[model samples]
Target: MPDWATFAGFAGVVLVLLLLLAHASKSAVSGGTPIRGGVDRPQPGSVDPAVAEVHASLTNRVRATGRGTDPTHATQPQLSTLALLANVAVSQGAFGLLLLAGGWFTEIPPSAFGVTAPVLSASTLGVGVVLGGVLYAANEVGASVGERLGIGADEGLREALAPDSPAGWAVLLFLVLPIIAGFEELLFRGVLIGVFAAGFGVSPWLLAVGSSLAFALGHGAQGPAGVVVTGVLGFVLAAAFVLTGSLFVVVVAHYLVNALEFVVHEGMDVDWG
Candidate 1:
Protein backbone atom coordinates (compact mmCIF):
# COMPACT_ATOMS: atom_id res chain seq x y z
CA MET A 1 0.00 0.00 0.00
CA PRO A 2 1.15 3.53 -0.76
CA ASP A 3 2.03 5.78 2.17
CA TRP A 4 -0.33 8.53 3.34
CA ALA A 5 1.90 11.20 1.85
CA THR A 6 1.75 9.59 -1.58
CA PHE A 7 -2.03 9.32 -1.51
CA ALA A 8 -2.48 12.94 -0.47
CA GLY A 9 -0.20 14.16 -3.24
CA PHE A 10 -2.02 12.06 -5.83
CA ALA A 11 -5.47 13.27 -4.76
CA GLY A 12 -4.42 16.92 -4.93
CA VAL A 13 -3.05 16.49 -8.44
CA VAL A 14 -6.20 14.73 -9.68
CA LEU A 15 -8.45 17.47 -8.32
CA VAL A 16 -6.51 20.14 -10.20
CA LEU A 17 -6.55 18.17 -13.44
CA LEU A 18 -10.29 17.53 -13.30
CA LEU A 19 -10.94 21.25 -12.97
CA LEU A 20 -8.66 21.99 -15.93
CA LEU A 21 -10.17 19.32 -18.17
CA ALA A 22 -13.70 20.51 -17.48
CA HIS A 23 -12.70 24.04 -18.46
CA ALA A 24 -10.88 22.93 -21.61
CA SER A 25 -13.74 20.67 -22.67
CA LYS A 26 -16.21 23.49 -22.25
CA SER A 27 -14.02 25.84 -24.33
CA ALA A 28 -13.63 23.32 -27.14
CA VAL A 29 -17.38 22.70 -27.25
CA SER A 30 -18.03 26.42 -27.52
CA GLY A 31 -15.54 27.09 -30.35
CA GLY A 32 -17.54 25.48 -33.18
CA THR A 33 -18.83 27.19 -36.40
CA PRO A 34 -21.67 29.80 -36.55
CA ILE A 35 -24.89 29.68 -38.64
CA ARG A 36 -24.87 32.75 -40.95
CA GLY A 37 -25.15 31.17 -44.40
CA GLY A 38 -27.47 29.35 -46.87
CA VAL A 39 -31.17 28.84 -45.95
CA ASP A 40 -30.74 30.46 -42.51
CA ARG A 41 -30.37 33.94 -43.99
CA PRO A 42 -33.70 33.54 -45.91
CA GLN A 43 -34.28 34.83 -49.46
CA PRO A 44 -34.77 38.64 -49.69
CA GLY A 45 -37.89 38.76 -51.89
CA SER A 46 -39.67 35.55 -50.72
CA VAL A 47 -43.02 36.43 -49.09
CA ASP A 48 -44.69 33.04 -49.63
CA PRO A 49 -45.53 31.19 -46.35
CA ALA A 50 -44.79 27.76 -47.87
CA VAL A 51 -41.40 28.95 -49.13
CA ALA A 52 -40.54 30.36 -45.68
CA GLU A 53 -41.52 27.07 -44.00
CA VAL A 54 -39.33 25.08 -46.41
CA HIS A 55 -36.40 27.38 -45.71
CA ALA A 56 -36.89 27.05 -41.95
CA SER A 57 -37.00 23.23 -42.13
CA LEU A 58 -33.87 23.08 -44.29
CA THR A 59 -32.09 25.46 -41.94
CA ASN A 60 -32.88 23.29 -38.89
CA ARG A 61 -31.79 20.15 -40.71
CA VAL A 62 -28.48 21.76 -41.66
CA ARG A 63 -27.88 22.81 -38.07
CA ALA A 64 -28.61 19.25 -36.88
CA THR A 65 -26.04 17.95 -39.37
CA GLY A 66 -23.35 19.79 -37.34
CA ARG A 67 -23.23 22.91 -39.45
CA GLY A 68 -24.33 26.51 -38.72
CA THR A 69 -26.88 27.67 -36.08
CA ASP A 70 -24.18 29.48 -34.30
CA PRO A 71 -20.71 29.69 -35.72
CA THR A 72 -19.98 27.32 -32.88
CA HIS A 73 -21.94 24.09 -33.18
CA ALA A 74 -23.50 22.53 -30.08
CA THR A 75 -21.67 19.22 -30.59
CA GLN A 76 -18.94 18.57 -28.06
CA PRO A 77 -15.36 18.42 -29.22
CA GLN A 78 -14.01 14.92 -29.91
CA LEU A 79 -10.98 14.54 -27.71
CA SER A 80 -8.27 12.08 -28.71
CA THR A 81 -7.69 8.98 -26.62
CA LEU A 82 -4.43 10.44 -25.34
CA ALA A 83 -6.15 13.68 -24.33
CA LEU A 84 -8.75 11.76 -22.38
CA LEU A 85 -6.01 9.84 -20.59
CA ALA A 86 -4.21 13.06 -19.75
CA ASN A 87 -7.41 14.59 -18.36
CA VAL A 88 -7.99 11.58 -16.13
CA ALA A 89 -4.41 11.70 -14.99
CA VAL A 90 -4.71 15.32 -13.98
CA SER A 91 -7.98 14.81 -12.08
CA GLN A 92 -6.72 11.73 -10.25
CA GLY A 93 -3.48 13.53 -9.46
CA ALA A 94 -5.27 16.26 -7.49
CA PHE A 95 -7.21 13.72 -5.46
CA GLY A 96 -3.90 12.11 -4.48
CA LEU A 97 -3.01 15.11 -2.29
CA LEU A 98 -6.01 14.62 -0.03
CA LEU A 99 -5.35 10.91 0.38
CA LEU A 100 -1.76 11.60 1.29
CA ALA A 101 -2.67 14.33 3.76
CA GLY A 102 -5.31 12.18 5.44
CA GLY A 103 -3.00 9.22 5.70
CA TRP A 104 -0.04 11.23 7.00
CA PHE A 105 -2.06 12.97 9.69
CA THR A 106 -4.65 10.46 10.90
CA GLU A 107 -3.89 7.14 12.58
CA ILE A 108 -6.28 4.26 13.01
CA PRO A 109 -5.62 1.73 15.71
CA PRO A 110 -5.84 -1.96 14.83
CA SER A 111 -8.90 -2.26 17.02
CA ALA A 112 -11.94 -0.10 16.34
CA PHE A 113 -13.19 1.93 19.37
CA GLY A 114 -11.00 -0.45 21.42
CA VAL A 115 -13.11 -3.49 20.48
CA THR A 116 -11.94 -6.46 18.51
CA ALA A 117 -13.98 -9.41 17.33
CA PRO A 118 -12.80 -12.95 18.07
CA VAL A 119 -14.16 -14.06 14.70
CA LEU A 120 -13.87 -12.15 11.41
CA SER A 121 -17.34 -13.31 10.42
CA ALA A 122 -18.93 -11.65 13.45
CA SER A 123 -17.21 -8.38 12.74
CA THR A 124 -18.24 -8.44 9.09
CA LEU A 125 -21.82 -9.28 10.00
CA GLY A 126 -22.02 -6.42 12.46
CA VAL A 127 -20.71 -3.91 9.98
CA GLY A 128 -23.12 -5.16 7.33
CA VAL A 129 -26.15 -4.85 9.61
CA VAL A 130 -25.28 -1.34 10.66
CA LEU A 131 -24.59 -0.21 7.12
CA GLY A 132 -27.78 -1.81 5.82
CA GLY A 133 -29.95 -0.16 8.45
CA VAL A 134 -28.40 3.23 7.76
CA LEU A 135 -28.92 2.84 4.04
CA TYR A 136 -32.54 1.77 4.51
CA ALA A 137 -33.35 4.88 6.57
CA ALA A 138 -31.55 7.16 4.11
CA ASN A 139 -33.62 5.65 1.30
CA GLU A 140 -36.82 6.34 3.22
CA VAL A 141 -35.94 10.00 3.71
CA GLY A 142 -34.94 10.33 0.07
CA ALA A 143 -38.26 8.75 -0.93
CA SER A 144 -40.17 11.32 1.08
CA VAL A 145 -38.25 14.11 -0.65
CA GLY A 146 -38.97 12.61 -4.05
CA GLU A 147 -42.68 12.30 -3.27
CA ARG A 148 -42.82 15.99 -2.40
CA LEU A 149 -41.06 16.78 -5.68
CA GLY A 150 -43.53 14.63 -7.67
CA ILE A 151 -40.76 12.44 -8.97
CA GLY A 152 -40.19 8.67 -8.69
CA ALA A 153 -40.76 8.37 -4.95
CA ASP A 154 -39.82 4.71 -4.51
CA GLU A 155 -36.91 4.60 -6.93
CA GLY A 156 -35.69 8.10 -6.07
CA LEU A 157 -35.09 7.05 -2.50
CA ARG A 158 -32.88 4.19 -3.65
CA GLU A 159 -31.29 6.26 -6.38
CA ALA A 160 -30.44 9.19 -4.10
CA LEU A 161 -28.05 6.98 -2.18
CA ALA A 162 -26.94 5.09 -5.29
CA PRO A 163 -24.37 7.74 -6.28
CA ASP A 164 -23.83 7.74 -10.06
CA SER A 165 -25.05 4.70 -12.04
CA PRO A 166 -25.20 0.91 -12.55
CA ALA A 167 -21.86 0.50 -14.33
CA GLY A 168 -20.01 2.28 -11.53
CA TRP A 169 -22.13 1.36 -8.49
CA ALA A 170 -19.58 -1.08 -7.08
CA VAL A 171 -16.73 1.29 -7.78
CA LEU A 172 -18.58 4.18 -6.17
CA LEU A 173 -19.50 2.30 -3.00
CA PHE A 174 -16.07 0.77 -2.54
CA LEU A 175 -13.68 3.35 -3.92
CA VAL A 176 -15.07 6.71 -5.06
CA LEU A 177 -17.13 7.42 -1.96
CA PRO A 178 -14.23 6.85 0.41
CA ILE A 179 -12.01 9.03 -1.73
CA ILE A 180 -14.59 11.81 -1.87
CA ALA A 181 -15.22 11.60 1.85
CA GLY A 182 -11.49 11.73 2.57
CA PHE A 183 -10.79 14.62 0.20
CA GLU A 184 -13.76 16.62 1.38
CA GLU A 185 -12.73 16.15 5.00
CA LEU A 186 -9.22 17.28 4.23
CA LEU A 187 -10.30 20.29 2.20
CA PHE A 188 -13.14 21.49 4.38
CA ARG A 189 -11.92 20.43 7.81
CA GLY A 190 -8.18 20.30 7.51
CA VAL A 191 -7.09 23.01 5.10
CA LEU A 192 -9.98 25.35 5.67
CA ILE A 193 -9.62 25.14 9.44
CA GLY A 194 -5.87 25.59 9.30
CA VAL A 195 -6.18 28.67 7.10
CA PHE A 196 -8.75 30.33 9.30
CA ALA A 197 -7.04 29.37 12.54
CA ALA A 198 -3.74 30.73 11.33
CA GLY A 199 -5.31 33.93 10.10
CA PHE A 200 -7.29 34.55 13.27
CA GLY A 201 -4.86 33.04 15.81
CA VAL A 202 -7.81 32.97 18.17
CA SER A 203 -9.13 30.24 20.42
CA PRO A 204 -9.40 26.83 18.74
CA TRP A 205 -13.06 26.66 19.71
CA LEU A 206 -13.74 29.96 18.00
CA LEU A 207 -11.84 28.80 14.92
CA ALA A 208 -13.88 25.66 14.84
CA VAL A 209 -17.08 27.59 15.17
CA GLY A 210 -16.30 30.01 12.36
CA SER A 211 -14.86 27.36 10.04
CA SER A 212 -17.79 25.05 10.65
CA LEU A 213 -20.23 27.81 9.75
CA ALA A 214 -18.32 28.44 6.53
CA PHE A 215 -18.43 24.73 5.78
CA ALA A 216 -22.19 24.70 6.24
CA LEU A 217 -22.59 27.64 3.90
CA GLY A 218 -20.56 25.75 1.33
CA HIS A 219 -23.45 23.27 1.22
CA GLY A 220 -26.08 25.80 0.14
CA ALA A 221 -28.56 23.23 -1.16
CA GLN A 222 -29.42 22.03 2.37
CA GLY A 223 -31.56 25.08 3.34
CA PRO A 224 -30.96 27.29 6.38
CA ALA A 225 -31.71 24.82 9.17
CA GLY A 226 -29.99 22.01 7.38
CA VAL A 227 -27.02 24.23 6.74
CA VAL A 228 -26.78 25.15 10.41
CA VAL A 229 -26.91 21.50 11.47
CA THR A 230 -24.33 20.60 8.84
CA GLY A 231 -22.09 23.38 10.05
CA VAL A 232 -22.08 21.91 13.59
CA LEU A 233 -21.57 18.46 12.21
CA GLY A 234 -18.73 19.83 10.10
CA PHE A 235 -16.90 21.03 13.20
CA VAL A 236 -17.18 17.63 14.85
CA LEU A 237 -16.26 15.69 11.75
CA ALA A 238 -13.37 18.00 10.97
CA ALA A 239 -11.95 17.62 14.44
CA ALA A 240 -12.31 13.87 14.21
CA PHE A 241 -10.63 13.71 10.83
CA VAL A 242 -7.76 15.89 11.97
CA LEU A 243 -7.30 14.00 15.21
CA THR A 244 -7.48 10.52 13.69
CA GLY A 245 -5.89 11.12 10.27
CA SER A 246 -8.23 8.51 8.82
CA LEU A 247 -10.78 9.41 6.17
CA PHE A 248 -12.46 6.08 6.75
CA VAL A 249 -13.78 7.29 10.10
CA VAL A 250 -15.34 10.39 8.55
CA VAL A 251 -16.95 8.31 5.82
CA VAL A 252 -18.49 5.94 8.34
CA ALA A 253 -19.57 8.80 10.57
CA HIS A 254 -21.13 10.66 7.65
CA TYR A 255 -23.01 7.57 6.59
CA LEU A 256 -24.20 7.05 10.13
CA VAL A 257 -25.41 10.64 10.48
CA ASN A 258 -27.40 10.43 7.25
CA ALA A 259 -28.87 7.14 8.37
CA LEU A 260 -29.72 8.47 11.82
CA GLU A 261 -31.64 11.44 10.40
CA PHE A 262 -33.58 9.21 8.01
CA VAL A 263 -34.52 6.81 10.76
CA VAL A 264 -35.54 9.66 13.04
CA HIS A 265 -37.80 11.19 10.42
CA GLU A 266 -39.17 8.09 8.73
CA GLY A 267 -38.82 5.17 11.14
CA MET A 268 -40.13 6.97 14.19
CA ASP A 269 -43.88 7.52 14.13
CA VAL A 270 -43.86 10.99 15.60
CA ASP A 271 -47.17 12.65 16.38
CA TRP A 272 -47.50 16.26 15.25
CA GLY A 273 -50.64 16.67 17.36
Candidate 2:
Protein backbone atom coordinates (compact mmCIF):
# COMPACT_ATOMS: atom_id res chain seq x y z
CA MET A 1 0.00 0.00 0.00
CA PRO A 2 1.07 3.57 -0.65
CA ASP A 3 2.38 5.49 2.37
CA TRP A 4 -0.18 8.25 2.54
CA ALA A 5 1.46 10.05 5.45
CA THR A 6 4.85 10.01 3.78
CA PHE A 7 3.35 11.28 0.57
CA ALA A 8 1.64 14.12 2.40
CA GLY A 9 4.86 15.08 4.13
CA PHE A 10 6.76 14.94 0.84
CA ALA A 11 4.21 17.08 -0.91
CA GLY A 12 4.31 19.66 1.87
CA VAL A 13 8.09 19.85 1.68
CA VAL A 14 7.94 20.28 -2.07
CA LEU A 15 5.39 23.07 -1.72
CA VAL A 16 7.54 24.90 0.79
CA LEU A 17 10.65 24.57 -1.36
CA LEU A 18 8.76 25.81 -4.44
CA LEU A 19 7.45 28.84 -2.56
CA LEU A 20 10.89 29.65 -1.23
CA LEU A 21 12.37 29.36 -4.70
CA ALA A 22 9.68 31.60 -6.12
CA HIS A 23 10.24 34.22 -3.45
CA ALA A 24 13.98 34.09 -4.00
CA SER A 25 13.42 34.56 -7.73
CA LYS A 26 11.26 37.61 -7.05
CA SER A 27 13.90 39.00 -4.74
CA ALA A 28 16.60 38.41 -7.29
CA VAL A 29 14.62 40.38 -9.85
CA SER A 30 14.23 43.39 -7.57
CA GLY A 31 17.88 44.41 -7.68
CA GLY A 32 20.58 43.65 -10.23
CA THR A 33 20.39 44.46 -13.92
CA PRO A 34 20.41 41.51 -16.28
CA ILE A 35 24.06 40.84 -17.07
CA ARG A 36 24.38 41.28 -20.82
CA GLY A 37 28.05 40.43 -21.31
CA GLY A 38 28.81 42.82 -18.40
CA VAL A 39 27.48 45.70 -20.41
CA ASP A 40 25.19 47.88 -18.33
CA ARG A 41 22.85 49.65 -20.70
CA PRO A 42 21.16 52.95 -19.92
CA GLN A 43 17.91 52.69 -18.03
CA PRO A 44 15.02 55.05 -18.58
CA GLY A 45 15.46 58.54 -17.06
CA SER A 46 19.08 57.87 -16.18
CA VAL A 47 22.43 57.45 -17.90
CA ASP A 48 25.99 56.83 -16.79
CA PRO A 49 29.07 57.56 -18.96
CA ALA A 50 30.49 54.06 -18.54
CA VAL A 51 27.19 52.42 -19.42
CA ALA A 52 26.57 54.70 -22.37
CA GLU A 53 30.02 53.94 -23.78
CA VAL A 54 29.46 50.18 -23.49
CA HIS A 55 25.95 50.51 -24.88
CA ALA A 56 27.20 52.58 -27.79
CA SER A 57 29.67 49.86 -28.79
CA LEU A 58 26.92 47.23 -29.05
CA THR A 59 24.22 49.41 -30.55
CA ASN A 60 25.11 48.52 -34.12
CA ARG A 61 25.07 44.76 -33.56
CA VAL A 62 22.41 44.17 -30.88
CA ARG A 63 19.22 46.05 -30.25
CA ALA A 64 18.63 46.97 -26.64
CA THR A 65 15.11 45.99 -25.59
CA GLY A 66 15.15 48.48 -22.65
CA ARG A 67 14.31 45.82 -20.06
CA GLY A 68 16.76 44.71 -17.43
CA THR A 69 19.24 47.24 -16.18
CA ASP A 70 19.98 50.69 -14.94
CA PRO A 71 23.62 50.67 -13.87
CA THR A 72 23.14 53.88 -11.91
CA HIS A 73 20.13 52.50 -10.09
CA ALA A 74 21.36 48.95 -9.58
CA THR A 75 21.08 47.83 -5.99
CA GLN A 76 22.89 44.51 -6.24
CA PRO A 77 25.90 42.89 -7.80
CA GLN A 78 25.58 41.48 -11.28
CA LEU A 79 25.01 37.73 -11.50
CA SER A 80 26.90 36.14 -14.34
CA THR A 81 25.10 33.97 -16.87
CA LEU A 82 27.27 30.97 -15.96
CA ALA A 83 26.50 31.31 -12.27
CA LEU A 84 22.79 31.65 -12.92
CA LEU A 85 22.73 28.58 -15.12
CA ALA A 86 24.73 26.63 -12.54
CA ASN A 87 22.29 27.55 -9.80
CA VAL A 88 19.39 26.37 -11.91
CA ALA A 89 21.16 23.12 -12.68
CA VAL A 90 21.91 22.45 -9.03
CA SER A 91 18.44 23.34 -7.80
CA GLN A 92 16.58 21.28 -10.37
CA GLY A 93 18.98 18.38 -9.83
CA ALA A 94 18.22 18.51 -6.14
CA PHE A 95 14.50 18.56 -6.83
CA GLY A 96 14.81 15.49 -9.04
CA LEU A 97 16.64 13.65 -6.28
CA LEU A 98 13.97 14.68 -3.77
CA LEU A 99 11.26 13.33 -6.03
CA LEU A 100 13.08 10.05 -6.37
CA ALA A 101 13.37 9.78 -2.60
CA GLY A 102 9.70 10.60 -2.17
CA GLY A 103 8.67 7.94 -4.63
CA TRP A 104 10.84 5.37 -2.93
CA PHE A 105 9.47 6.18 0.53
CA THR A 106 5.90 6.37 -0.63
CA GLU A 107 6.22 3.00 -2.38
CA ILE A 108 4.98 4.61 -5.55
CA PRO A 109 6.06 2.99 -8.79
CA PRO A 110 7.64 5.18 -11.44
CA SER A 111 4.78 4.32 -13.76
CA ALA A 112 2.32 5.79 -11.29
CA PHE A 113 4.14 9.09 -11.68
CA GLY A 114 3.98 8.78 -15.49
CA VAL A 115 7.61 7.77 -16.05
CA THR A 116 6.73 5.03 -18.47
CA ALA A 117 9.29 3.87 -21.00
CA PRO A 118 9.11 6.30 -23.87
CA VAL A 119 7.81 5.10 -27.20
CA LEU A 120 10.17 5.70 -30.13
CA SER A 121 7.55 5.79 -32.82
CA ALA A 122 7.36 8.56 -35.42
CA SER A 123 3.72 9.23 -34.55
CA THR A 124 4.60 9.85 -30.90
CA LEU A 125 7.33 12.28 -31.90
CA GLY A 126 4.95 14.05 -34.27
CA VAL A 127 2.31 14.37 -31.58
CA GLY A 128 4.69 15.94 -29.08
CA VAL A 129 6.10 18.39 -31.66
CA VAL A 130 2.66 19.38 -32.91
CA LEU A 131 1.33 19.80 -29.38
CA GLY A 132 4.37 21.92 -28.46
CA GLY A 133 3.87 24.17 -31.50
CA VAL A 134 0.21 24.70 -30.64
CA LEU A 135 1.06 25.53 -27.01
CA TYR A 136 3.76 28.03 -28.02
CA ALA A 137 1.26 29.80 -30.30
CA ALA A 138 -1.24 29.84 -27.46
CA ASN A 139 1.38 31.25 -25.07
CA GLU A 140 2.12 34.18 -27.40
CA VAL A 141 -1.58 34.94 -27.65
CA GLY A 142 -1.89 34.79 -23.86
CA ALA A 143 0.99 37.24 -23.45
CA SER A 144 -0.73 39.58 -25.91
CA VAL A 145 -3.96 39.27 -24.00
CA GLY A 146 -2.15 40.07 -20.78
CA GLU A 147 -0.74 43.19 -22.44
CA ARG A 148 -4.18 44.29 -23.62
CA LEU A 149 -5.55 43.85 -20.11
CA GLY A 150 -2.92 46.24 -18.73
CA ILE A 151 -1.25 43.51 -16.74
CA GLY A 152 2.27 44.89 -17.29
CA ALA A 153 3.68 41.48 -18.01
CA ASP A 154 7.46 41.67 -17.97
CA GLU A 155 9.82 39.49 -19.97
CA GLY A 156 12.79 40.81 -18.06
CA LEU A 157 13.24 37.56 -16.18
CA ARG A 158 13.45 35.70 -19.44
CA GLU A 159 15.88 38.27 -20.73
CA ALA A 160 17.97 37.94 -17.60
CA LEU A 161 18.08 34.17 -17.88
CA ALA A 162 19.05 34.25 -21.53
CA PRO A 163 22.49 32.88 -22.31
CA ASP A 164 25.19 35.02 -23.94
CA SER A 165 27.12 32.78 -26.34
CA PRO A 166 26.39 30.00 -28.81
CA ALA A 167 27.74 27.41 -26.38
CA GLY A 168 25.62 28.89 -23.62
CA TRP A 169 22.57 28.63 -25.83
CA ALA A 170 23.28 24.97 -26.46
CA VAL A 171 23.51 24.27 -22.74
CA LEU A 172 20.42 26.31 -21.96
CA LEU A 173 18.27 24.68 -24.61
CA PHE A 174 19.52 21.10 -24.54
CA LEU A 175 20.58 20.69 -20.92
CA VAL A 176 18.99 23.25 -18.61
CA LEU A 177 15.63 23.50 -20.35
CA PRO A 178 15.18 19.74 -20.52
CA ILE A 179 15.85 19.43 -16.81
CA ILE A 180 13.33 22.19 -16.12
CA ALA A 181 10.66 20.67 -18.31
CA GLY A 182 11.13 17.15 -16.96
CA PHE A 183 11.19 18.14 -13.30
CA GLU A 184 8.29 20.59 -13.56
CA GLU A 185 5.98 18.28 -15.49
CA LEU A 186 6.80 15.38 -13.20
CA LEU A 187 6.30 17.32 -9.99
CA PHE A 188 3.29 19.40 -11.04
CA ARG A 189 1.48 16.96 -13.25
CA GLY A 190 2.69 13.48 -12.46
CA VAL A 191 3.01 13.46 -8.68
CA LEU A 192 0.92 16.36 -7.38
CA ILE A 193 -2.08 15.75 -9.60
CA GLY A 194 -1.71 12.26 -11.05
CA VAL A 195 -0.47 10.19 -8.12
CA PHE A 196 -2.46 12.12 -5.55
CA ALA A 197 -5.74 11.94 -7.45
CA ALA A 198 -5.32 8.27 -8.20
CA GLY A 199 -4.28 7.38 -4.68
CA PHE A 200 -6.94 9.45 -2.93
CA GLY A 201 -9.65 8.49 -5.41
CA VAL A 202 -10.39 12.12 -6.25
CA SER A 203 -11.05 14.00 -9.47
CA PRO A 204 -7.96 14.71 -11.54
CA TRP A 205 -9.56 17.91 -12.80
CA LEU A 206 -9.89 19.22 -9.25
CA LEU A 207 -6.31 18.28 -8.53
CA ALA A 208 -5.31 20.02 -11.74
CA VAL A 209 -6.73 23.27 -10.36
CA GLY A 210 -4.65 22.97 -7.21
CA SER A 211 -1.53 21.93 -9.09
CA SER A 212 -1.94 24.72 -11.63
CA LEU A 213 -2.14 27.31 -8.87
CA ALA A 214 1.06 25.98 -7.37
CA PHE A 215 2.65 25.91 -10.80
CA ALA A 216 1.66 29.53 -11.37
CA LEU A 217 2.95 30.59 -7.99
CA GLY A 218 6.25 28.85 -8.65
CA HIS A 219 6.75 31.21 -11.59
CA GLY A 220 6.49 34.36 -9.43
CA ALA A 221 9.60 35.77 -11.07
CA GLN A 222 7.51 36.37 -14.19
CA GLY A 223 5.45 39.08 -12.49
CA PRO A 224 1.65 39.31 -11.98
CA ALA A 225 0.52 38.74 -15.54
CA GLY A 226 2.85 35.79 -15.93
CA VAL A 227 1.32 34.08 -12.93
CA VAL A 228 -2.14 34.37 -14.44
CA VAL A 229 -1.14 33.28 -17.93
CA THR A 230 1.06 30.49 -16.57
CA GLY A 231 -1.78 29.26 -14.40
CA VAL A 232 -3.91 28.86 -17.50
CA LEU A 233 -1.04 27.20 -19.31
CA GLY A 234 -0.51 24.87 -16.37
CA PHE A 235 -4.14 23.82 -16.48
CA VAL A 236 -3.92 23.13 -20.20
CA LEU A 237 -0.80 21.03 -19.67
CA ALA A 238 -2.45 19.27 -16.75
CA ALA A 239 -5.43 18.47 -18.93
CA ALA A 240 -3.07 17.12 -21.55
CA PHE A 241 -1.37 14.96 -18.93
CA VAL A 242 -4.67 13.59 -17.63
CA LEU A 243 -5.96 12.80 -21.08
CA THR A 244 -2.80 11.36 -22.61
CA GLY A 245 -1.32 9.61 -19.56
CA SER A 246 2.16 10.22 -20.91
CA LEU A 247 4.84 12.27 -19.19
CA PHE A 248 6.98 12.14 -22.34
CA VAL A 249 4.39 14.07 -24.30
CA VAL A 250 4.19 16.91 -21.80
CA VAL A 251 7.96 17.06 -21.28
CA VAL A 252 8.65 17.31 -24.98
CA ALA A 253 5.90 19.86 -25.42
CA HIS A 254 7.09 21.86 -22.43
CA TYR A 255 10.71 21.85 -23.65
CA LEU A 256 9.63 22.97 -27.08
CA VAL A 257 7.60 25.85 -25.70
CA ASN A 258 10.53 27.08 -23.62
CA ALA A 259 13.13 26.43 -26.29
CA LEU A 260 11.10 28.24 -28.90
CA GLU A 261 10.55 31.18 -26.58
CA PHE A 262 14.29 31.60 -26.10
CA VAL A 263 15.07 31.04 -29.75
CA VAL A 264 12.51 33.46 -31.09
CA HIS A 265 12.81 36.22 -28.52
CA GLU A 266 16.34 36.23 -27.19
CA GLY A 267 18.16 34.64 -30.10
CA MET A 268 16.33 36.40 -32.91
CA ASP A 269 15.52 39.54 -30.92
CA VAL A 270 11.90 39.54 -32.04
CA ASP A 271 10.87 42.08 -29.37
CA TRP A 272 7.37 40.62 -29.14
CA GLY A 273 6.65 42.76 -26.14
Which is the leading candidate under lDDT?
2
List, residue by residue over 1-273, the lDDT tens digit for candidate 1: 323344335434543443343333323222222333322321111111111222233334445676654433322233122222233334433555644445445432222111134423444445534543554454446446644664421211111122233433444334443444444554555444443333335454665676566556544333333344456567776665445434345546554544343234434534121
Could you give candidate 2's per-residue lDDT for residues 43-78 as a string of tens digits?
211001111122222232223444234443222223
In order of appearance, the predictions have TM-scores of 0.38, 0.79
Q: Every model's Cα RMSD, please?
A: 15.3, 8.1
Output the number of the TM-score-best candidate.
2
True lDDT of residue 234, candidate 2: 86
Kindly report which residue stretches of model 1 are placed more than 4 angstroms away from their true locations once superposed. 1-166, 194-202, 239-248, 255-273
